[model samples]
Target: MAVRQVIFAALGVSVLALGACSGDGDPILMHAGAQNRGPDEFAILPTKPLELPDDLAALPAPNPGGANRVDPQPRADVARALGGNPAAAVSPGAMDGGIVNYASRFGRNADIRAQLAAEDLAHRQRNRGRLLERVFAVNVYHSAYEHMWLDKYSELERWRRAGARTPSAPPRELLDN
Candidate 1:
């Protein structure tokens, strides 16, 4: 009876250990986004929204590590206007709205994540995940691996200078090959 009980206990512990390692992600490829969240450095934080670029070809060259052209950062300007610190305004603070209630002044981005996830499902359907990504549930790591780190603004300038239908570069994998 004592031997039988010890066997059962050992089996249970082994099962638990295996269960811990058998998660959705591959341990070798899953370390991105694990650091402390910080302010986006490459983002262009204009004090106000950009007007339509009359001469589309004359804008500054976009960085590979930058945000898109149209992300609206209206709060920084608003906070400066209202005599509040722009840094304090920009940093997330639910209860620290200096001039007006945050809820009253701004629409909460609480549901924005869920909305983006829903759109991402549609995007995945269109783009189609690779076999390894689908099998190992490596969406995050796969995105990091597959990202095209190009300077869109510089690419636009290159195209403008060519003054012809310049052929686009092939995907990174082709270059690797």
Candidate 2:
């Protein structure tokens, strides 16, 4: 009886330990590990209502590859709903010219997003876990970036010691006497 009770207790503790290690850590870093539970709410969008024209013959000839009359135009619809010019929203270059020009003044790489995504994927792959960790599907994101971690409070104190103004920084924690 005593031997059986000890065995059961050890088994219970081992099960709990295994359960603790099986969790998906830091969802932002484990996007690839995310399971699809249901349909994405944002992907389901309502189409524009169908409208009958008073003069049917006045409509342009239907082009097989052209935009449909009832197709959802989210940007234009949003602009129109807000009493703004829908035409301006539909044509990108026509509106916000000054802002766009200022932002791209230093020159712009059209494939910047794609380039960055490739670079990030390469970085993550390079910093991936060891054979055992990979086999077990354990996340190593935090450990991989451990060396790059900054000590913000120490940095604030260092700047203060150097006579740099740190007006925005909160007062340092009070040390007990």
Candidate 3:
């Protein structure tokens, strides 16, 4: 009778343990003493397709020309009156009823040319800044790596002098392993 009771108690405890381990349908499992082969061996299944929001479906396509495509005639007139174009015979820096003839020698609007020049200058300035930043970053990284290599070599020499087992070759960690 006592043996029967012990068996029943053990069975009850095992049943509770199994119940506690019930999962929410995740399929992967790992066991002790198993080597992790890498991401390819233990990857999760692909997820369901994502649904785009309803409001995004109604959004209009963007205009390819952007905002700068609008006519700047009024601004061009102001530029022309400023003596930007000699052929127009408009006095320099003079505002003729807010309609300046900003025409250039090439017959192009001076205001448009000025706007393009400003944009070009800004683009070149940004590129220069980016180039300088990259150069500085590369120099810093090179210097840091040089210092680290020197420090590692010095430590290796110290170990050798202390009669420690000097490897026939440098340590694997020291190589690009």
Q: List the residue pairs that clash in candidate 3.
A: 77-99, 77-100, 78-100, 79-102, 80-100, 80-101, 80-102, 81-100, 81-101
On the 0 to 100 scale, the lDDT of residue 154 in model 3 is 65
* lDDT ranking of the models: 2, 1, 3
| Candidate 1 structure quality by residue, lDDT tens digits, 21-138 | 5665434434554433454577755544567988888988878878554655467668878999866765556546664464557656668899998986776576556775555454
Tens digits of per-residue lDDT, candidate 3, 99-142, equal 44444434655488889889866754544434544543222323
| Candidate 2: residue 162 lDDT (0-100) | 97
> Clash totals for all models, in order?
0, 0, 9
Q: Which parts of model 3 are misplaced by more than 4 Å?
A: 1-140, 144-146, 170-177
Write down the lDDT of every candidate, Cα atoms only.
0.63, 0.79, 0.55
Model 3's alpha-carbon lDDT is 0.55
1-177 per-residue lDDT for model 2 (tens digits): 999999999999898679767764555536545564555789898886789999998998879988786887778889989999976775556567988999999999999999999987897799898986776667787667678889887888889899999878776654211
TM-score of 2: 0.49
Rank candidates, TM-score, best first: 2, 1, 3
Q: Model 2, residue 176: displacement in angstroms?
A: 21
Which parts of model 1 have CA positions greater than 4 angstroms off? Answer: 1-110, 130-177
In model 2, where is the ten-residue run with the lowest total lDDT? 24-33
Inter-residue clash pairs, candidate 2: none
Cα deviation of 19, candidate 1, in Å: 21
Q: In candidate 3, what residue range of length 10 has the lowest lDDT sum?
A: 24-33
Best by TM-score: 2
